[model samples]
Target: MLELLGLSRVGEAVYRSMLANPRLDVGALAAETRLTERQVRTALDELADLALLSPVSGDGALRAVVSPEVGLAALLASAEEEAARKQRQIEQTRAAIAAIAAERSAGRSGNEIRRLDGVEAVRARMAELALTATRECMSMNAGAADRPDSRAASAPLNQQALERGVVIRAVCRESFRNDPETLAHAHWLVGLGGQMRTVPTLPMPMVIVDHRIAILPVNPHEAAEGAIEVDTPGVLAASCALFEHVWATGTPLGDAAAAGDDGCLPQERALLGIVADGHTDEHAARKLGVSLRTVRRMMSDLMERLSAQSRFQAGVNAAKRGWI
Candidate 1:
């Protein structure tokens, strides 16, 4: 227990032995504590340094143990003072960081929305944002990139953020589960305490950090086109609202898709909604991050279930039954 106050085990043993019998010399202490005489001597030196052992009057060969009440209380008080000093330093450092962040932010217009012209620029800005994020990291992906190199590059940063106790939430298309590589990445992220959820479709690829900075693709369907960085309060609020809405409706990763109260799974409902919007099977497939064949198969099963002969009839039937 005294170790917390910088007391070594040998020194504590020697001290305790001396406290029990003040007349015990170094040899007697070693014999009693089962430590070598050299160890006892070392302990004696340590105790003397700590002011726990003092020379006994008129006998340089004998030593006295300072009462633990006085010696330990002094040590405890010193440790507390050191801890307080460190805490103050921590607070000062935190304040300095806040000041720096604020000064940097003030230099930029509060409502500025800057365009990042190329993928490299976007990647560089993203790295900067990720590095400075102090709170939550949120993102919505229309689909996984499924690029091993990109995933490998991002793993270290993601792991670092997670280790720093940052909260991470991501929403991706459920069809990513169909791809082995994407599924593995999602599982790996979740295993590291990062949260992941899935929806049938996402509007676009977007990232928001600390609820203050947002990065949005220039084109909803093509992230390679580049992105825009926005710190506008209104835009950030809207972006956060959209994320929360999608997140609330999403299924947790690894969960089995189940039918809703309307007798249609989320994927089925999303497909029906997409078809109702006059999109082709290919368009729906792209939005859902699935293959055209999968979209067609799902449509076929839905039509059979509705006992409708055509897509239009199925839509009408679904509407009448409140399935869409």
Candidate 2:
């Protein structure tokens, strides 16, 4: 019965002692339970806090005692309350699980893809889908100015997605390095363990996920215009292939420091080779006869292209995206 009530052994002993001998002194209670006086006092305080005991006056003397009727009532009430709370929590959990199951079922149906228009609409859909993503996110973004509203729009939803254990992989253009806003955006993505990379060139803003969902801008200059969402295997495959081609030739963020001192556009393969040698930025820059500022600028550009918050994140992103 004590175990059923979730009472520890010591608590059970204290409770039993109180029940058997109401209004007993703390010292007597301790003796009965063979526990220390401090232990008895603590247990009594805990039981009283739980409303299992009541203060009473015995022959004009104040004493703590178990109330035969009230004690039973309090115990029963506590049990009922605990049961109700657990039931409500279980119901909520079940509802959430059911909702997820429904979404997965819908995703697998392979029906028509949903089309959304306007920047606001696209942001809204990305937020919604990002909230639901479980495994991974793949994106091809046109630097920051292309979607000024994306940060605030995608932040909350992206955070929620990360909490759900989704992995993100993003590809952007080399122009991202020059834009502070875009670099900050890349930082946010990297902070969430998402991968970012930059290419020398890009077609337009697009987002692809799990080889199933694709988002493409209808107009190259107008992201807010109607965008198409494609779920077809052929179209998704083609877009994914395009992403791979760019990724293959892009410079990794970490390798920027070692590529050259003169800040020459390091060949992608050569940059990787230098990075593999584990040389420091300063040493690599001196070897190539480039200034520290130039090295830093090149590194910054590399991180921007990779959408990395730090060199470490950039490396991780590049590896995951198969860029390096």
**lDDT, each prediction:** 0.87, 0.67
Taking the tens digit of each residue's C-alpha lDDT, what string does model 2 give over 1-324?
A: 555554567877888887788757778888999999999877877776666666675674324666547765667778889999998996687468658856775866563566787877887777756755667788777643335665777777777667767877777666566667767777776777777776544666678766678888788666657688888888888988987776676655424423433333433323333444676777444433345675567667767877898767766665665556
Give residue 119's lDDT in candidate 1 (0 to 100). 75
> lDDT by residue for model 1 over 131-180, one digit each (tens)?
56779999998864467776786787788678768899999888888889
- Show where candidate 2 strays beyond 4 Å: 1-113, 145-148, 253-263, 266-324
lDDT of 2 at 315: 65
Candidate topping lDDT: 1
Which candidate tops TM-score? 1
Q: Give the C-alpha lDDT of model 2.
A: 0.67
